[model samples]
Every structure is written in C-alpha cells, then in structure tokens.
Target: MTWLIFAFLNALFESLKDVFSKKGLRYCDEYLVSWALWFFADLVLLPSLFFMPIPELNARFWWALAIGGTLNSICAVLYIKAIKLSDLSITLPIVTFTPIFLFITSPLIVGEFPSAIDFVGVMAIVTGAYFLNLKQRSLGYLAPFRALMAEKGPRLMLVVAFLWSIAANFDKVGLENSSPLFWVISLFSFISVALFPLVVYKSRNFTGKLRRGWRSLALMGLAFAIAVSCQMQAVSMTLVVQAIAIKRTSVLMGVLWGALFFKEKGITERFLGASIMILGVVVMSLF
Candidate 1:
C-alpha cells in the first residue's frame, strides 16, 4: 500500500483500538488494560523479526528508546486512565492538545519555529477545544476551559500531550539511526519491558483482569499493532506530517464511536468540536 493508504488505515485502526480499549476498560482494571495493549501487541509483533533484518544498536538509539519508551509507558497509563475517568468524546478530543503543545515544544527542542499559519492553527485548535464543552456554556464562557481543569482525565491528558511532544523528537532521533519497522519493534519491546514493574505493582489481579477482558483486549492490541505498524510504514514512505495528519483523523472516529457505541453525552457538540480540532491539525500540517 502507498503511504496515504497506510496513513488512513492507521487512523481507522487507531480509532478501533481506542474504542475497544474503552470497552475493555469498563470491566477491567485500567492498569491491566494498559498493560494488555502493549503486552498482547508485543506478542503479535515478535514474529516479524524473522522477516526483517535486525537494526544495529547505537548510543542515540538506546538513549531515545530509554526516554521515549519511559514516556510512552507513562502516556499509555495516563491515556487509559483518562478513558476510564471521563467520557470518550471528552478525553479523546483533548489529545488534539498535542499538536498545540507541539507549537511550543518544536521550537525549543528541534529549533523549528512556528509560522503565522501556526498561530492561526493554534487558535483554531484552542477554539475547537473550547467548543468541546460548549454543552456547559450555561455556566459561563470559560466553562469549557474550567471543565478541562476540573476533570482529572483532561488534566492528565494535558500533561500527556506535552510529554508526547518531547518524545516525538526523540523518535525522530531514533529513526535517524534505525529503520522505522525496527524502531517500532524496539520501542514497543522496551515499553513492555519497562512497564512490567509498574503494571504488576498497580494491578493486583492482572491475570484475572486480562482473562476477563481478553477478547476486547486482544482486539485492542491487534488494532494497535496494525495501526502503529502502518504508521511507521507510512512515515517511512512520506512526510511525517502527511502520515500524522491523516492519523489524527482518529479523533473524529473516536467521537463517532463515543456516540454510537458508548452512548456518551453531548455527541453532536463533541463531534463538531473534534472535527474542528482535526481541521486545525491539518492546517498545521499543510503550513
């Protein structure tokens, strides 16, 4: 498949993964569910080593893996925890904050400065995020921002966004020293291994939880594996922004699934808000 096709597939599978994860989270411990995402997916990815050549290790690759893998583990935990704690529509849309944070982080880390269009994109994203909670506008104009601050999930996701912004650059550094497929495999392996202690400590009945939610967890893991693989393939084939801009469409899918499957509240507004947020991301990418 071409990069565009893979990028679109990545978005579709990512949405499916999030929906399945939220479904599993309803019955399983969030920590265990988080572990299942990486653990089961790692199992699926392990056999691919026979088909692909192993990447040579370097200090840059190791440092990037250590930092990026640790942050990714933190993000995985926080992301699932947010799903457990808030409406899918609400929490998923908030992740759009990542690009917005990128506008700040990119210049500092990578020396990539934002353009005037970047400012406009940032404004558009902030506006969309505001409208996400427009259902609570009866309280005041600041209700949406207030809701973001008051909710534990949104607050945690906010931090997750910033961390991802930083980790993303390290991923590029890793890619500079290795192939994308190898990078994906190495990254996930490290994450699964690194998360072992925390997952075991935080989840008292991890095995039981995995058994209870095995089907959903398996589906979630399968989706994640495919999505991330496609993402890596897509990124390797084309501009990273092209792959990610398409992948961010997952936010819209999350909104749709939130309404149809989960029956979350305020679907219309959230969908509109997420669409706007995604559009802003597209603009950020194009500019």
Candidate 2:
C-alpha cells in the first residue's frame, strides 16, 4: 500500500514534469534544455548525498548509472524531437507505451518470464496506443496505423521507447547496488550535463534561447531528481514491475494536461486511449 502511494506520487510528479517540459521546449532548444536539466538535476542531487554516510562504490552502480544516463539522454532528445514534430496528443500516446517496452524487455534483461496476465496488460497497452493514434472523427481502426507508418514522430518515439525501457529496467539494479542514494544520480547528471556546454558552444544563433531555457531546464532537473528519488523509494519497497505499471498512469495525466493546458487536437480519442492505458496499468498492478 505504501509502495503504491509512492508510485502514484512518482507518476503525478513525472506527469507534471512532462507537461512543463513540453511547454518549456516550445521556447528552448531541445539539446540545450536537456543538458541544462541534467546539470541542475545533478546539483539537486548533491545535497542528498550527505544525508547518510557514503558507502563503498561498486561496478554495478557505475555501470547502471552510466548506461541509464546514456540511454536516458537518447530518450530525452528523441522525446523532445517528437514533441516538436507532432501534436502533443499524437506524440504523447505513442511514447506512453514506454512501459510496454519495459514489459517486453524485462524478461530478456532481468531473466524473469512474464506471467500470462502481464501479456494481457501488454495487449491492452497496444490497443490503447492504437486508439490514441487515430483521428477523433475517423472511427477507422486502421487510420492510426496508417498515419503512424507514414509519420516520423512514431519512428522517433519508437527509438525513445526502446531506450527508455532499457534505462528503466536498470533503475532498480542501480538503486540497490549503488553506494549512496544520490551520489550515483549526481554522477550521472554531472556526466550527462557536461555535454550541454558543448551543445551551447556549438550553436551561435540559439544562445539567447538557450539562456532563456536555462531556468526552466533547471526546474525540470529538480523535478526529475525528485521523481527518480521517489521511484527508488517505491522500488525498494515493492516489486519493480508493479511499481513501473503504476507509474504508467503518468500517461493519463500527461494526455489530460496536453488537452486542457496545451489545447492539442484529438482530445476525445486520446482521452479514451489514455484511460485504456491507465486501466491496463492498473490491471497489471493488481493481478
């Protein structure tokens, strides 16, 4: 129960982060903003390292963070690109199957075979994503599939989903095997953000935009840092698959915010799709 609560909170904050990030991305360069976010997230992580005595580091911890950070960087960049390329309604649902990627890959990566119920949940997620890609008025079941096949956002989102799945699968391994709660994240953030200066240094025309994006990116970093910490807390207390399934509710929240705040098109079908996705996640968590 406590883990569920933690997972719920994690989902909520992460949804908010997605909302704010999409808004901020409208005014910022994707790479520069992502870089700033990692930089500030590391800064937020630093103070937490002192909360308890630092423990001995292990190769697993470093490997987890390094690999997670690299993959996450790829996910972040692709996500922002998708946001720029498609309507929030379209792109978000496509990316929402990130957990599906995890579900499919978990067995391979963690060596745990999924139960029959897990397969059902994956099917539900696929159905939801399919509906989300269709036009609200089309009612044509194949329309979304046709649109996705011809579009770039779906392709980009697919790459993002795969990378995100890999990162998420390693999250638990990194958290438990790590020396300190915040140190590994801090290191990952530092290494990842170190690439931002290079990004900014390379772009002359986007300097003003980059400066403007810095503050929002920093805030995103803080939110993400907190989100990751909360996720770790949940994973430590509950089953990793259950925690991840619950966290997928963020898709519902993000789609809602996209419709209400961003005024994106195709709200009706997206809402239905989001609800189905949430239902699938809930079912996955329950049985």
CA lDDT of each candidate?
Answer: 0.86, 0.72
Best by lDDT: 1
Off by over 4 Å in 2: 1-5, 136-140, 183-187, 205-207, 236-239
Off by over 4 Å in 1: none
Q: TM-scores of the models, in the given order?
A: 0.95, 0.85
lDDT by residue (109-170, candidate 1, tens digit) is 77877788877878888998888888789999898889867988788888888889988888
The Cα error of candidate 2 at residue 189, in Å, is 2.0
Could you tell me the lDDT of residue 203 within candidate 2? 51
